[model samples]
Target chain A: MLNLLFSLLFLLSLFCAVLTGKETETGRALLDGAGAALRFCLDITGSLCLWSALSELLAQTGLSGRLSSALRPLLRRLFPRSAREDGICEALSENLSANLLGLGNAATPAGVRAAKGMAALGEGGREELALLVVLNTASLQILPGTIAAVRASAGAASPFDIMPAVWLSSAVSVGAGLTAAFLLKKLWRCYR
Target chain B: MALLSLTPLLLLGFSCLYALALGVDAYGALLTGAKKGLTLALELLPALVILFAAVWCLRASGLSELLCRLAEPLFRFFGVPEETGLLMLIRPLSGSGALAAAGELMETYGPDSLIGRTASVMIGSSETTFYVISVYYSAAGVRRTGWAIPAALCADLACFLSAAWISRLLWA
Candidate 1:
């Protein structure tokens, strides 16, 4: 998929360059892209490092486990077939907490762990997995750190002034995603 | 809103308190995780290089303008400005791709503009649907993600549409 996307975009760039008679600029843009990518990575690294480290520390302290237990009622509601003892709740809750912080780097490991747990015990079929996937994809955000960082770096007067709007849009999206997932489950049952 | 953005700092403080309470070498844990993060960031670099460059080329090649024109009517229907059409198209496929576009919008239109605010709010609200699907499904050994695509895409549409509407209502 990555290869296909890369090649397609490259070809599109070349074709457009030829059409516009701006062929020389395309090569220069590619080099500039490389530099921008590096700078972008470095800019994000500090936050990633801090958040992931704190995440690891939280996990190590067994606090995530406790938090997971605290979240049991909700997790069970989301993944109804899954049991608390199965450890799915723990990972899912941790992932949720990380996601709530807008810490995708921190969320990744927990999300991966949740996936592994679901694969092992969630023989409940596609519906269960769909719920998990929807939860992750449309997960709500409080900070929206990465986007705010971009706004800040771009010299926005107040990078986070977009937050209230972000919070509203994200809540709406997640609600929409869950509704779609529920609707799809019913449709799937009819087909089955 | 200011307090919301400070959640990360709050989490950091919580970790410090937890580490102190547990007596579990908090500094070591932090460093260990940072090392892991550094490695992960490095591994993600190649994809970034390709995506950023491709996105830049797409815009510089004037292809973005053409694509935007094609999607302009849809954006119009959603009440989003035509300038944001490229972002709406690329957002679901790639997070970095959308980020690059948003950065450009911020630079060109200024982050406080209707265009920039819409871009940021949309990017903030939606996930990279295809990317998340591939990663999470493969990791969980989920072979048949039945009905997930439409479900998630619904959410993406919600984000896209609402970002335009809400940004307009609140900012403009």
Candidate 2:
């Protein structure tokens, strides 16, 4: 899917540049494109390092276990079987909790660990994996600090003034996502 | 806004206090895990490059504008501005790209303008759906992504469609 998008973009850019007589501009854009991406990655490295370190501390201190127990009822419902597995449940709980706090950068490592743990369950777990992906991709973000900051920087008198709108739209998305995932999983099972 | 800026510090302090109370070698664990996390980011760098390059070219070459032109009527029905139509598509694919695009719109339309407000709200509401899928599934070494793409994209659409309405109801 990504392959298709990338190739199409490259081709379209070339065609557009030629049509508009802006061939030189396209070359500049290409280098600028890579440069922008590199800078973006580097910018994230600082937070990524901090969160990774924190996650490591989380495991070493067994806070993840405490966290799992704390959120046991909800985690169990989301991941019934895996919630019984201490190691996996720890990662899953951390991922979901971090995400809810709008700490997606912090959520990545734990999300990866949780995904890896679910994959270890072997066959017949594809549905669970799909559900996990959907939830992670569109999970409600209660804080959304980054967006608020952007709004503030852009000079909004009240950056978080849109929190109610964010909450409403996010809940609607998650609801739609969960329903689609459930229906898709059922249909997939019958087909298989 | 002040609280939002302090989140990272808050989380950091809480974790440190928690680690100290637990008598853990927090510093050692941090270095170990940070190194591992850096490596993961390094490995994913190529994918990020590909995604950003494509998005950049799409914007610079004006194809995004063309695509927006084609999709305008549909998005307009949802009350999104013509200039921000590209954001509805890009927001679900790349976070940084979406951020850059939103910044551009906010710059052009003023942050409090309808276009800027819609973009701002959209950022908080939607996720980088494809990016999340690729990262998680690849880390898990899962070959089959199943119905995740469709389901997540459905959520993205919901966010996009509601962004304009939500922004108006709140800010208008």
Candidate 3:
């Protein structure tokens, strides 16, 4: 799937550039993009390491265990059988807690850990994985500090004024995403 | 904003203190977790390079802009300003790219204006859809993503529409 999308984008870009005689610009962008991605990887590594280390500490100290157990009832509803697995539940709870706290990039390592844990459960975890991806993609952040900061720097009189709108929209999106995921899964099973 | 920036510091401090209280080997655990993080980073690098290249190619070739222009009417029908067309399209593809677009829109339209507010709300609400899907799926070794992409894109659409509508309801 990624291959197909990437190929389509690559071909479309090539065709568009050729048509507009901007092939040089496209080539430069490709190289620059790759270079930037390398730099981004290096940059993110430090944060990922820090967050993952914190996650380990949280888990080892039973802090995240407490957090996960607290979150278990809700996660159980969302994840069903997968919530029964202690490993997956802990990883997921950490991810959810990070996200709720608006930890931004810090949430990814825990999310990745959760994803890996879900994958370990084999095919039965498929629906749970999809739901997890949907929840992450919906991204219900409580503070949304980054955007507010952007607005402030841009000189908005009330940068956090849009908080209500952000919250509402995020809530709506999560609902929409989950509904779509479940409906699609049902449809998929029927088709099979 | 200060509190926002201080969150990670507080989290780190509190977690470490808690770990110590629990008699956990925080240092060794950090080392072990860092190793895992490094491995995850290495695993992610190839996909990141390829995805970035694809997105950059579309952006540099003006294909993304073209798509945005073509989709402008649809966005407008959903109450999104036509000026924010590129933002709606890019928000799900790349986080930094969307931030840059949002910043540009706010600067051009004035952050107090409807377009600026809508863009800000949209950015705050939406996630990098393709990025999240790819990273999570790849990390989990899922070759076939099934309906994850479509479902997540559905969420992004809801986010965009709701952002525009709610922004207008309160600010317009």
Question: In order, what is each prediction's RMSD in angstroms?
Answer: 3.5, 5.3, 6.9
Q: Tens digit of lDDT per residue, candidate 3, span B9-78?
A: 6666887898788787888988887786677567657765775676678878999788778977887777
Who is ahead in DockQ, 1 or 2?
1
Instruction: Report lDDT (CA) for all predictions.
Output: 0.78, 0.74, 0.78
* DockQ per model, Cα: 0.58, 0.48, 0.45
lDDT of 1 by residue, A17-109 (tens): 999988888878988987888887776676556656766676677665565567667877787765454666677787777677666766778
Report how far off residue B38 is in candidate 3 (Å). Answer: 21
TM-score of the second chain for every model:
0.71, 0.61, 0.60
Error of 1 at B156 (Å): 2.1
Tens digits of lDDT, candidate 1, B80-167: 8888766777788877677777876776688889999999999888888888889889988778888898899998888888889999
Looking at candidate 2 chain B, the ten consecutive residues that score lowest on lDDT are B1-10
Q: How does each model score on TM-score?
A: 0.80, 0.70, 0.67
Q: Is candidate 1 or candidate 3 better by DockQ?
A: 1
Candidate 2 lDDT by residue in tens digits, B28-83 = 88899789668755754675566556666767777777888898897677676677
Off by over 4 Å in 3: A1-69, B1-73
Overlapping backbone residue pairs in candidate 2 total 0
